[model samples]
Target: MSSPTPSTLRVGRRYRAKRLNGPYDAIVIGSGIGGLTAAACLSKMGKKVVVFEQHYTAGGFTHSYDRNGYEWDVGVHYIGDMGADHTMAKRLFDHVTDGELKWAPMDANYDRLFIGDRQIDLMAGPKAFVDSLKNDFPDEHQAIDSYMGYLNQVAKALPGVTLAKVLPNLLAGPFRRLANRKAPAFLNRPTQEVLEGLTGNQELIAALTGQWGDNGLVPTESSFIIHSLIARHYLYGGYYPVGGASEMAKTIIPVIQQSGGEVFTYADVKEILVEKGRAVGVLMADGETVRAPAVISNAGVYNTFGPLLADNAPHKAFYQMKLGNVQRSMASVCLYIGIQDTAENLQLPKTNFWIYPGTDHANQVDNFLKAPDEHDIPLTYISFPSAKDPSFAARYPGRATVEIVAPGPFEWYADWADKPWGKRGDDYEAKKEAYSQRLLEKLYEKMPQLRGKVDYYELSTPLSTDYFCRYSTGEIYGLDHNPERFEQDWLKPKTRIPGLYLTGQDVMTCGVVGAMVGGLLTTVAISGLKGLPLAKKMFVG
Candidate 1:
């Protein structure tokens, strides 16, 4: 490994035991988009909130790092529903960031899917998207129209479903039942099943479900509800934060500080302090305890229930049983590449690429998992960050960056779990090198013009995710987006424990906007009547 390249890209204030201001109304664990949103919203409500992030930077998955004279974002690649100011995503972002953060729109052709040897482009706008699909599959025009209609149906039913998560128990039960009745029968069915019923053409189904990796699940295994949500989200085209993903926390932290709140980094939380079956505060790893009236966990379900909470608590057994029902989402490896030339010079497009071995996504994934070393890589997603963000040229002149992501299970790197990051033995290094070479080969296959133009590259494995983000299994998207996973009534924002709440992707779905919605839902759940006005602005008016 090369000498440590220091990251001058710090966001939140460094945490110390003495720096903690006391008598906070709420303590939020983790500074992911969800936690930050909740903290900012509660701050607007005149409540003092403190957010703790175990990583060196805030924004969790949305964080960016500077290394080897280049910068790369961890999770945020492209977000949808940002082009219009009336969108919920834009409204929520403006509310939290105080309208300081801006968005840059991507190309009209936002996504290109290469399944086996065939290619399909998903364009922006409903007419463009339908026209592109119709042009490719002229015989399946009816199916494409039906697919768009179904997405609209999901959009209509989403508000009721999202509202149920924060509603009181008595109101929520009937609301869920009503939502189920009003929703399409194929809402929770598998994506493949629903799409196949609409059109018998397998190629059309494959093209439509090409973005399956966005949710970390194949079509046959994932819920149609999640697929509809993701498809409708990008229908209007994809947008990146104008300044980069780190601007998420950069803009929201001021809102938190306005109400005497702070987001602290390097703040390792040891456990939640529970007294009389209610969470009162958190015990930091530094042997200091910070007390608050309410404690919200955006760390994820497994982390919250497995390590943070006590074992002998009344709800421990119940949560453990609930955990058994749902499995972790897919872990991944990302190859971050740096180029010395500018994005314009490199001719990189402001579009994402989703490559698949074949149209049978589920089968390909199964075969690869059965024998990872022998089978072909199931999916490879490549993003050009420098091309997407308009402000990249000013931040790092004469430079560009690319990110390639693919599935990598935790078991592949379990032996190196105990080793410190960047100091793993030669064996781990060799394994990473092998995967990195394969991913680069995929990139070269698509754009072979610059075969040897790469300046620097590094591959981050599942262990890297665990070490940095505190995900025990290196799961990226929190829990899986299977049909059964969404059926859990306990996955809502409000926990049974008195002063405890849940937020982030685990509470809702997965994505920057999904997690932020979870944060908003949590604030509503906690504030009750006080949050109704804000909720009315965001949801009703």
Candidate 2:
């Protein structure tokens, strides 16, 4: 073994102006899961691709960091649909990582929702999930059954919906219409509306939408499509990457290099070089121009259209119009906690805890946003990373880690956005400390044993998110998963600009798997007929 350096946790080579080996086939900006996936997929098809990341690490949100001898994942808490080898998510992951990345199944009781005094446990497997819910609300069995049926319907309708993103407008228009007709009329309706139509029980609706935090939307505002997708995704329960979230990029990078491609960290992309209305290359922050036939942006639509692409691009007006249709997602604060003892000794469960002030999720969120200090936190999500990842002990012996995530509007932290990280004045530090203490109290509410057991903890505000992730407003998920967001036709892989494409959570939905799937869809859209075999294997086989 080697001694760990400051850059030990980071993957990918450091960006240097002299290291340009292009005229590559594709230049992917942002080494997030979406960008890495696209580069790896294209590389597998004998294309020389290069990925540029502004962060010190490669994995945008998937990267894990070690601090004070403890490691914690930045964004990736858990992923779904990895239990079976034949699943599309599993297959794609295997293909990208060359079967190197592994997954560990979470507890059968994957999520525990604490709604005031009432507690609801969402178990793994369809039958078990329904049974558990039915156990809680015996009188609303019919509604539960109906909800499950809608999930099934959404699952059935998803392929066509995904296909439309890759297909041209001529082919996609008819296909999307057919797919829409096949799906339920209420499929794209507001989640709250759909659930209320099924049953008048507010508590049941709250319990059903407990996982709304997964997509950063309230039941009243989120589209039922996203609601159904997130619900169906975790029906089999959650799974953490076996070697930690960073393993995703660590393993995938090798596959990308197989075809002479590389993912570069600290590679700040200044702008997408457009010539004659075509994205021909990218201008680096260091004043180096790397040319490629294609330019794919895994950065969100705002970054691509607002900053990367020039203001005078051919489709500037069109994209600006498209941008008006969608809105940025949630900003949050995460308290990364480190425990001195081992996870096993500390008795931590792999099950995630979703603590809420009350059953009224939407109202609570609205109230909290209005005056954060006045009201209690709308939702507090607690995840045991050390317990979830089986290999944590081997990596960092006698250490355990926990992450507490709660919504924090960007406006609250806007004043400190321009301040350098770690030097944000005393007032900012005091605010973070206040929030951190409150979050610690919430954690102690469930597991009081961890009160003094916590060895170290640090709170990350929205400013930290903006600094690291480049989300100006510290939006966690790229775009809001609302009804309006889904209706935007421009949120697809292929953009109006020639040789320009979009991928990541913005293109599809949020979540690690969602963005990776978006990357796959972008590969298909870019490859056109050449990608059919890969598509058939993934979507068909």
Candidate 3:
């Protein structure tokens, strides 16, 4: 429990001069939050580590891309619980990186749900959120109150809820006793299934689950647990990184590197190096093998144990079986737009607006996939990156960035999955242009003033996501977070093969906070919570 010598924290910075090195303590594949958190925690524990990222920059899904002087978050638009003074997300980041990152709160309304023809804003704060919903269905006041109560209940039960999945029988005696069985009891139920028991109002339920697309679970498939987390996270409000999405990784990189670790982008791990049935290191794509005692894979389970392992890799079939059963989150078609006018001038709402053609959250994909032409796709998903972070405006004055995302089926770009993006041909271009126009028109419908002010825009299809982010099938949120996904005991930080571990979205839950918390789990597994687990830190920190 003694502090790691200050020298240990500086070891990674001057390893060559330290003259007391052996194998790296840990080798993390991918610099996503989960990986970074694990690396930072390991570093703090005096473990020299190295993180390898295949992309040119770190922050797997949380990274942002720039074009024409404007930047759009590739994945994160805003995060929640970061604003809470002692929130687990904030505490984990602060500890892992020694308080390096900064978070900015989003507008008052975290998200706007447009069902059928009505636009409903989900305001920040529990009371505000429930009040806003009350405006839509005045008669459901009791239901709204009941729902809010459940949100708070779910929040309190999450630690026990999650521990129930990972802790073995010997260590879980106390944890299981502390756990709220009433919480995970609902995990086996679908989001829609639970909503019905809570309320019978059809439209109200649709608005609540409008953002289920983020989790790749329609109301019918998503777990009640996941649904409550997302809705409640934003109930307090959403917070974007002050410097945009890249800051999410940038702030933590120095902390990771300071802990005798390195964060390397553009260093692809060609294979997971194994020795005597345990992970020992990673062979980079360029044939360079970096040795380490342990490996933490932020790459989703499908890629970590499925694709990266060797021909006779131990526990390969077990992971393969898990992959065969778990559903993947939906891929998306994003139109990244760099507008010449300031978002302020456009009077753009700080809260994102998710517009759907109808109120059937259950039939969202069925309509899109079955009748792709008439599908209406979640009409529009509006995000203003400029509004989230004004500092980004200095990089591109007089310009604003807007990104629209919608569900895109695998079939849309199946032919070009292996081909490069821009080279995908005329059909791809034509389809992209049509979808982009549809989204833009919806944007125009929402905000009529900024019709022709778009400076430049381009579509990033599933092919682009795959090429850039290295997702196996262009799935955005790692594995699909369905009701069944949470029930799978196999999805945790530990691995069947010793020294091999998992991280990223698949570990905890999903979202930036969820993924980072997942990294926290891996860190705990690596060093036994820095010799001071949460119980001790509750008073010690």
Candidate 4:
């Protein structure tokens, strides 16, 4: 195996006290898609925004990293709803990147699900998707059609839900009530309940909810709203960023800089400064204070309310109390594999593979969590980054990359939580090695050709997520997408404290597009009437 080397994929300027260009209009606490989107929108509105990112690179989960002559995307695998320019997700992405970010469509069969010995393919396009499923289960065509209807119902009701997040507190309640009256009764119910109402066939429900891992929850626990959002978002098929995941930050940062705004990497914000009962600025880890009238936190609710805010800050107690209402999402371990040959030579497919032990997803997940070794691996997702991105071959000749992701509960690695990254001791390394071998075996089972072709591989536990993304418990999707989670109206762009706001997955749902919407709502909330034109362009156009 080759020794690890430094990554060359860094995208943002290094942060330093001296590099500080002050008198900023707003301060964004993190450079995730949410923060970047908000910054870019504000920049276009002529606001000089400064974004601080604690990692060495920007783009948060959308960032790509390299080592040993190979690169892998940490979070982004396949994004949907990009094939058409009229899509809200596509329009928002274009707006943030100034139309420079491009997407490459995946195969029509974007996602393949393996349930025990049975297999199912989720095809792109609404008609094809339903037709494929009908071909598999010919007797239950009505259930499949009804499932699609629920997705459309959620889609129609979503705009009102989003509008509620940005509206003033006085108007939000009435708006939410009106929206709920018009929405389908099953919108925010448990996904399993809604699906079971449509069909009693266990196999069909399993196939329908096979993509539950996308939202980090099983059908029984996840809210139908989130499940529908994810399912509908990918109904048109998946798309990979043209240049790679890092292209997001690469394209968006220039727009931020176009208006004197900058995204600074290696910038650690120790605390958010609150004075006279309002947010003033932030205190950096280096003991420098950068002041701005508005403070926006993309660090997530846990970090923003628990660590970032001072204990005595106004409404801190209220937020801390509110934190108990939601739980953190699942954490996972990823095995990144690098091969010497090109993806074309290796015959890697652009489609994503989701392997499951059986059709009982919730029970399977429960059993695995109780005794990981005794049960079959609940879920193993494999993505071929090299094959998906058209530019990957030119960037790294004669190379291919594969990523396998599976649940890795934080408690499994809690003993080594205090240890530094990459230096976690032999025992920790041994644990990771065992998990890596198990995951690699799963990959080899599906694609035997790559069994001996793997040139290098590494396993990253939840610890890696904590070290890199600052998700304390290594939760990837911010907060859990359970039924109860949607009831918290407090999870919005505007916080109770004056001049302090929240953005990112915690504010809305989870996913690159979901967080981007959170950023859009934050910009709209901050801009008030001035943001109407921008909102119209993104939401209406």
Give the number of the best model, judged by lDDT. 4
Residue pairs with backbone overlap in model 4 = none
Query: Candidate 1 — what's its lDDT?
Result: 0.92
User: Considering summed lDDT, which 10 consecutive residues are worst modelled in model 3?
Assistant: 8-17
Residue 221 in model 4: shift from native, Å? 0.1
In candidate 3, the residue pairs with backbone N, CA or C atoms under 3 Å apart (3 or more residues apart, or in different chains) clash, namely 12-260
The parts of candidate 1 lying over 4 Å away from their true place are 1-7
lDDT of 2: 0.91
Off by over 4 Å in 3: 1-22, 165-184, 529-541
lDDT of 4 by residue, 255-356 (tens): 999889899999999999999999999999999999998999999999999999988899999999999999999999999999999999999999999999
Q: Can you write out model 3's per-residue Cα lDDT over 372-429, one digit (the tens) per residue?
A: 8876765467888888886866656777888888878767878777666568778778
Query: What CA RMSD would you report for each candidate?
Result: 1.7, 1.3, 6.0, 1.4
Across 336-371, the per-residue lDDT of candidate 2 in tens digits comes to 999889999989999999999898998899988998
TM-scores for all candidates?
A: 0.98, 0.98, 0.92, 0.99
Prediction 1 TM-score vs. true:
0.98
Superposition-based RMSD of candidate 1 using all C-alpha atoms, in angstroms: 1.7
| TM-score, cand. 4 | 0.99
Q: What lDDT is reached at residue 122 by model 2?
A: 96
Question: Which ranges of candidate 4 are over 4 A from the true structure?
Answer: 1-7
Better of 1 and 2 by lDDT: 1
